[model samples]
Target: MKTYDEKHIKNVVLVGSAKSGKTTLAETMLFEAGLINRRGTVEDKSTISDYHEIEHERGNSVYATSLHTEWRDYKINLIDTPGLDDFIGEVASSIRVCDTAVMLLNAQYGVEVGTELLWDYIDRYQKPTIIAVNQLDSDKANFSQTIEEAKKFFGPAVTVMQYPLNAGLNFNCIIDLLKMTMYKFPAEGGKPEKLPIPDSEKGTADQLHNELVEKAAENDERLMELYFEKGNLDEDELREGLKIGMMKHQVFPVFCLAAKKDMGSGRLMGFIDNVAPSSVDMPAELLENGKEAPCDPKGPTRLFIFKTLVEPHLGKLSFFKVISGEVSVGQEFTNEKTSTVERLNQLFIADGKNRNAVDKLKAGDIGCTLKLKNSYTNHTLNFKGASGSIAPIKFPHPKVRVAIIARNKQDDEKLSEVLSEIHMEDPTIEVEYNRELKQVILHGQGELHLSLTKWRLENIYKMQVEFIKARIPYRETIQKAANSSYRHKKQSGGAGQFGEVFMKIEPYFDGMAPLKEFPVRDTETHELAWGGKLVFNNCIVGGVIDARFIPSILKGVMEKMHEGPLTGSYVRDIRVSVYDGKMHPVDSNDISFKIAGMMAFKEAFHQAEPQLLEPVYDVETTVPDEMMGDVMTELQSRRSIITGMDNRSGFQVIKSRTPLAELDKYFSVLRNISQGRAKVSIEFAEYAPVPGELQRKLTEEHQKELATESH
Candidate 1:
């Protein structure tokens, strides 16, 4: 395939909900462009985009695949992305690099939760977009109804550019409203036959044409005046106005297609070539030197790594978009983030499993470079002496966590390395060691996402891992004030250890209530007494306790602060006061004082009100109204408290607070309840005290486990 410069290149990402035929549409486009002689079907596992083993087994796209096709003298670099919410990271990365987004909607399903989510992301990035109503040949497809749904969810900017000639299985042709002509295709393709609109459909076609003209005119004041004065617009004027409006995101042209039948695929391609913005039409690259540099191939090199893939055999492949200047093989660029220079070797354009070598890559072109020393997704590459780095794309933090352990000891070391490489490829995925639980956790958007990563670990990296339930990070704290004393005495050999400590434990509730001595005034006014401070006073005026032992007692108290009496977990928000103590001159030592401090703290903590704190999460769920009741009931069962609910367009937005532990398996439950119509986002909210009985049980279990582990 011939390469195109920035002016002729169009980077578009195909995005939408699951099973929306986004991959099929990409396949059809490739076929129509003559990139592939015979079109590969999704079910047969022969399609170029869905090439992964898991994708073929599931018959859906599992990751984003970049494919380039030449059509109408333009190079369309299409990134076909997975629609499932689990793999949204791929969609996000694709959106970050693409100049435009083409959202594919299943004609039968119309707009869906994932479609809305992708729309929001596009809006957030302020990228121009086009909506393609696909699967028109499906039995339940309805073009008009789908258009209405699109307009309702995406606003009135969704103007129909083409109207289907027929619905369902008879859908073989479409009327181009802008051109005011109808094109029909034969059962087997050569080229679509252009014909005048049929008498019966001419009236509807004319109405659609008028709507398109009016929408286009509204984008420009002069055009609107001319349209109102002449009751029409010239074809050239209309096209120019619509193009400008689309670039500004004031208008979104909707086209219909049956990707499976390859109908309207050529027309869709033509529209993209004519309407989509080229690299120059899009925004200029913001260089690291705090300057808005034009997309000039002759300028200094500046590329952004938007995606990374780690293949066990092939090593790490870093996919980047050249924002400024040109990059060639054997040339080195500095990674501004890490201050490391990496050489570009074997520059290649990715098309699923195939990589076509290219001698040089220009600005606005997406290509891959292998075996970079310190390059990963979101890293900005530039020439030396660049003042600042380009801002990285922000992705949502992973809210869901799953504990994963190597299935066998043999895979442990390999699992660690594989997980690190995977995390590097997708920054949204996080792997961390939970010190308290003694487990390695893999966190992501949902269960399926983590599961897929595990599958890749085994199949792609040859590392076996087991997914286990994650443990909640619980904390312990005191509820009230209590005082206790402990004496440590031991006599064995010539020298013995002896220490005595009198300590007081109290709840430290800052900004909650007045201190015991302050009453309603500020604690500063009553310096002698305060609620939050841990006071250590030397009251051994008569030499009852040795002064040398005071520091040891405080050290012992500090060590006891880590594990509370209520649970074998870190304790917080408590004050410990060491008032007085006694010690023998020769026997007094740090070890004896430390033991006394631990005993006194345990007794005092029990005397005070002890409680366990569990992590809470703020959750937002978007679901259809019909499924609201079910979702609410499930949340209630999980001990969630509904904070608010609002109607957002046709969907219900539910905001609630749920314990993190309760939401561990929420992704699967939500899928089952909403039938995959719901999308949820969650973040850490705060920590709240757990109930008394549950806290007691958890504390006992934790203590027993710790004892067993120590033994």
Candidate 2:
């Protein structure tokens, strides 16, 4: 309802481990800002941030919620994101557009696995961050210990800005080193009474204050010179220095807060309003042409969609950050990625699930609009024929996969439509129709992620679906060369079918010349659909077989390649030369030659020592040093070859090469082994030969399946 300039706007995101009171802190902030009359708790599932039904059922945030508050004339756009790493896309989207990130640490547990995982993205974006060690009222709260861990994990930049005098139970009083005053909040938790530091705690407070001053001054040259001359920085100078330090990621100020009780939030808000860097202070955004564009309201209109949510009644709610210029309602802009013009029919700033309609969104601000065709998350909307677009976000790859099918076959068609909608909302849920595997595979972060997807399908879409381990796409290739011939002669009635084919097969390699032992006219090559190459060198000598029947022969060979004879898998990497063949004048039709070529290729493939190639993955796992031995031992048992090991900040990163077949449901096993303190990412590597013993077993299983089908 009020207009704010870029200098008065602050885009912030609250991120940390689960149950760290981020949602409660947001609720308290909204309440204090006069946006809400009352604060809602997570136990009742009535908090503004965790308003979704699934979030209520899970008692935690499952998606990011957008909300804003006006604190002391500054508009703070706060996005509360999910703490579960499974839904990291939400966190990533929030970080992409935010100017600052407030990382909440649970005082009891200190730095956790989730916190460590989130640091990578925060570092990637290089956003200015503040550490708020929360839940100081709990019995297990250990502010000192938590700060020590934070410094150890996050580095020396985690400087102290506040210290709790009495943390647990009696956590109302805190000494603010930034302002050099002690704040004592009432038991009711409204406003705090600022008082001078007591004589008993003056020495400790002064020491901490000096450390804060030094940390701030070290980030800026002017401040460093002033500090060396005057022995300290004034209040205004300290804030200016801190702002510079924050933007450069040279300092991470830690504050104390009992968020649920609404203590210490007022001080935090004050700091954000007075010192946090604005969009103008940030570096210029890089465009598609590698040109930096400043945040100028007079420049071309550009908005980057960071997140998208599709509701029951609301079609598509797109959350975007205006990168340049002002966009009034009904203004049309070109979708840089799609090259299509889209009009913003209406613009609204998100308030949880509700919207506050705005006439215009200015540069360096976050807002949302609905129902834009041909636009989704990560798409940048700019003026027509603009020079460039904003870079796209790189989402993490899915770590777990399952083949899904509709329980009720009628819902199968509906399943695809709903899946597309889900994918639009959450890119982490990968749904693919793998023709080679003959199944639709759903890839997600872990089992919980897929379980939630199934729930949504059953409850929201009214569809029945089943999740099963996806079949690995194995390959079949040959090891040696062989020549074989077959004659297909079928005579039952008056007419007869007769054709003979002689083919020499050898393993194909890139840049190798096709077999030219005999004179040939045409050389046809086909790239196999899955992988490798297929070359047919027509070495038929003279007029042994008709040239017209050559395609038919190649087609027959492809049919066998589509479903290999050894294990029913796709075949690749082989050169076939039809050096010799026999055909009858009246009986040698396309069918006869095709059958003869298929039979001859199968015979030669079996004789050439056909081998099975299993898909392998390059896996990287980061675990605590105490659990590294256990994790490596477990991985070895799963037939994983350890590639390398490196150490990082009390953690171990182990890289390995493991077969995909051995990785089915491996995420759960990895988590269990490390007690949820480990993270893993797997990517497809080159296919390797299956072990001889496993190959024999797989062949036997294939034969049994064939026999059952025949019966």
Candidate 3:
């Protein structure tokens, strides 16, 4: 394999809504570049980009697949990403390391929720963008409408470079605004015949061409002067202006394509080869320590792993972008995250399942290495003496979670190891063993994401797993003050057990006044691990209770706090004062005082108007104006409190606070009601008191559970 210089390499990530034909476009690009003799389609399950069995089964891309085309004078590394929002992690990882993002707008839909969702990542990274209006040959294709929507959502930076003379059924010609010519493709659609603009379409093409020139000129002062001087930008000048505009995110040049028919793909590839910014042209990579690492082949070697894949027979393949210097097989680097030395035993430029072994990859190149013991996605590896690491990609937090258990109890340990491997591959899928809930929880982007993980576990890992509703981690707190006394006394043994404790319990807030009924001698406020604070007051005046015995009493109180009196939930934000207690010196042991204190705290808690608090989350749902009523109605049914409302890119954003209990499979519900047109993000807000009815029901259920356990 030939290695290209950083200046001659372009990393372009294809991203858009699902069914936008990104995978088909990838296949067409490879075929047009002569990297492949024949093109494949997603329908035929032969496209290089959708090589995974799961993706083939679903008829869509799942994982982002990398392929490269060594076009004339340049090597364009293409990262074909899944368009579904559930697989957005793949998109995010691809965009972070790419020089430009080619966003495909399905002509039929114009702009969709998936487009809007992926746009968030592109906007955040501020990467140069190209908007490709795909499926222009579909009967329902509407290029003009797609352009208008792109401008509306992506803003005025959208600049049209080409337009289909006939966009629907018989679409075969594209008017190139930059070249002031026409590209008429053969019905088979490979290389296009360049022709003069016909007089019939000359007027429209000239107008668009002038607009393109002006849009390009707006990016650079020199280009603006050149355009003003000549009333036009020459081809070279226009390319320079567009490249600058793209790099600065001031212009998102748009093109039209019918990827399925291989129409306009050669022109698209030509634009990428000639116009797209290379990694060397981009700004220096930002580092975690607020430093920059310029893409220099002579600089110290640094590799940032963006994706990890574990093949059934191939072991682990770590895909990375050379942030600096160059890497070759047998080169050694230390993983900044794991602090383990790893040798690049093998290197290959990936083309779907094909690994073309290469000896060296220079700066700005993307390639994969086999069996890097400690390296995984988001990890940075540095050569022996090189320090510092690349800034890690920030994956989105999970919006849905469920408890996962192996169908066979004996597979529990193996399931855990497999889950870790899955998390290593996709950081968006978080796994945790919630000790309180006694269940292994799997958190992911949505129902589809979790279901895919389950499918992989059962199919690839050969483990039967079941997903169940995760229990809400509720908390217990008091609403008022109350006092109670308990005596733990027993006379069955030679040494009797006798310890009495009297304590007052009250709701504790950050700045609440101290108790006046009993003077607090020493205050010890504990920050509970679950949430909130527990303040223990030493208030036994006149030595009514020994100072040493007070800790035992507090220990007892903590036990009840861990297992709340109402619902066996963790208790928080309360103050306990032991104002008075009696102890038989000989029989008053730590166990005796602990028991008395626990009993006293529990009794006082019942009288303190105890309340159960359920975890609440801040949920923001973005939906079209037409579907807001349905989404709002569904949210109301979930007992959601609307906190705020906003608008973004023609979508209405509804922000609400809802209890965790009401969020089970909430993503699925929202998808159904909005017909998959809505997007939601959830984050933990704060724990709030459950409604009276819910509290009553929960307490009853807890009592029944205790009754059953006693048997």
Candidate 4:
């Protein structure tokens, strides 16, 4: 393989909704460049991008695959990303490293929910994007409507460069506005013959051409002046103007394609090679220290690991892009994040499952190295003296959660190891062993994301696992004030344990009045690790209880707070005042005071109105207008409180606050109600009180479990 400099290397990521023909487009581009002997279809599971076994089983892509093609004078590295939002981690990482994004729009569906969902990520990075309207040969294809929807969602930056003369079932000819020519393809559809624009369509073609010219000229003052002087720009000038517009995100040129039939792919690739911004042309990458790293081959070597994969035979492949200088085989670099030295023993350009070994990779080129000791995804490798590392990719938080249990009892440790490996490969899948819940929980994007993880664990790791219901992290607190005293007197052999504690427990808030009955001597406010505050008031008078033993009393209160009387949940937002207590001079110690204080707090908690609090999430569900009512009904049925509603780009956004307990398998239910036309996002809002009946049932369940355990 030949090495290309920054100017000649273009890193592009293909992103769009599922069934938008992104994988098909990638396969067609490779075939057109003669990198592949024949094209592969998704139906046959032969495409280069959708190469995973799970993808084959699901008939869709789940992982982002990397492939490269050398066209004309440039090397276009393509990162084909999965379209489902569940796999959005792949798309986000790809977008972070790529210089350009090629978003495919399926003509039959126009702009879909997935398209709208992904546009947020693309717009966040402000990546130079190209819009490719694919599947024009489908019977239901509507090119004009798709373009209209794209403009509606993406704003006025959408610029049409080409449109099919006959979009549906016979999309063989396309009118190119930039060149003022027509491309006519044969029935077999490999290459096209250029011809003059037809006289009948000249008026529409000229009008669109003038609009395209004005759009391009708007990005540069020099191009605007030249266009006004000559009434038009030359081919090279137009390419230059469009490139400027792309870099500024002021223009998104649209093209037509039928990737399955191999029509218009050649022209799209030609445009990418000729007009798209290469890595060197893009803005310098931002570093952690607010500095920029220019793509200069002569600078110090730096590489950013964007993705990691573990194949069955191949141990680990860390895919990275050369950020500054060139890297060759056997070159050593320090992992900035881990402070470990790693040598690039072998470098290869990845093409799906296949890899072509290369001696050197220059700046802006994407390649993978094998067997790095400490480096992983989002880590940066730099020379020893380099100061700052590249800014890491921020993956989205997990929206769905499930408790995982190993079916075989002996495989518990192995299950943990497998989950760790999975998280290393995909950071979006988070694993936590919650001590309070006593369950190993797996958090991910959605149900599909977690089920796929289960599939991998069972098939790849050969471990049987089951996903159970994850318990909610509920909290317990008091709603009123109550006073109680407990006497702990026991004699175990030599020393007798005798201690008595008198305390008052009251509901706590940010600013509350102090106790007026007892003279306040000293006050201590403690912040609980779980949530809320534990205000401990030492109101004892005249050293009735020693100052040293105050901590012991507070510790006892905390012991009861940790395992609340009801449901064994953490207690928060409460104040306990140790006003008076009696201690046996010899027998009273830390343990005795702790017991007495714990018993008093528990007795007072039972007398006071104890309330159960569950986590609430702010959920935003984007639903189509036709299915808005159904989605709204579904949310209301789950004890959700409607917060607000918004209208955006032909979709309705329903915002609500729902309890965490009511949101189990919520996405699955939403998908079923909307027929997969709705998208939802959830975030922790605040903790709210649970209903009386539900609280009673939960407390009873906890007591029964404790009773059974006592046996």
Q: Relative to the unseen true structure, what is the C-alpha lDDT of residue 663 in candidate 3, on a scale of 0 to 100?
A: 89
- Between the candidate structures 1 and 4, which one is better when assessed by TM-score? 4
Question: How does residue 562 of candidate 4 score in lDDT?
Answer: 88
Q: Compared to the true structure, candidate 3 yields what TM-score?
A: 0.96
- Weakest 10 consecutive residues of candidate 3 by summed lDDT: 111-120
Best by TM-score: 4
For model 2, what is the alpha-carbon lDDT of residue 623?
A: 83
After superposing candidate 2, which stretches have Cα over 4 Å from the reference? Answer: 186-190, 199-204, 332-334, 338-345, 383-388, 490-498, 506-529, 533-552, 575-578, 584-594, 624-637, 642-647, 652-654, 669-675, 700-711
| lDDT per residue as tens, model 1, 1-711 | 465788888899999898889888888888888988988989899998998888888888888999988898988999999988888889988997898898888999888876766776798777888899998888999888888888888888898889888878877788999888888877654368899999999889889899899989988999999998999998888887788888888888988788888888788788778878877787776655657866777777888899988765788888888887888888878888888888887899888888999998888899987889788898888875344567677777786899998889887887787788788889878999877657898889888888788888878877767899988877777778898999999999999989888877777755544334311211111112211234333344555666666667766765666655666666666766666678887998889988998888889989898888888899999998899999999999998999999987678999999998799789899999998889998987887989778887887887898799899
| Per-residue alpha-carbon lDDT of candidate 3 for residues 201-301, written as tens digits (9 for 90 to 100) | 98888898899999999999999999999999999999999999998899999998988888888888889989999988989998899999989888999
Ranking by lDDT: 4, 3, 2, 1
- For model 4, residues 1-711, the per-residue Cα lDDT tens digits are 777888889999999988899999999999999999999999999998889899999898999999999899789999999988898999999999999999999999888886776777788888999999999999999999999999999999999999999998877899999999999999889999999999998999999989999988989999999999999999899999999999999999999999999999999999999999888888889999999998888889899999988766677899999998889999899988888899999999999999899999999999998988788888899975565789888899999999999989999999998899889888999999999999999999999999989988887778899999999999999999999999899898888887888999999999898889888788889899888999998889987788888888899999888899999999999988988989888888888888999999999999999999999999999988999998888899999999999998888999999999999989998888877667889999999999999999999999999999999
Candidates' lDDT values, in order? Answer: 0.82, 0.87, 0.91, 0.91
- For candidate 2, write residues 446-553 as lDDT tens digits: 877888899888876778899887988889999999999999999988879988999999888889865657676777778987988888888886788988888888
| TM-score on alpha carbons, each prediction | 0.91, 0.89, 0.96, 0.98
Which residue pairs clash within candidate 4?
none
Arranged by TM-score with the best first, the candidates are 4, 3, 1, 2
List of clashing residue pairs for candidate 2? none
Candidate 1 TM-score over all chains jointly: 0.91
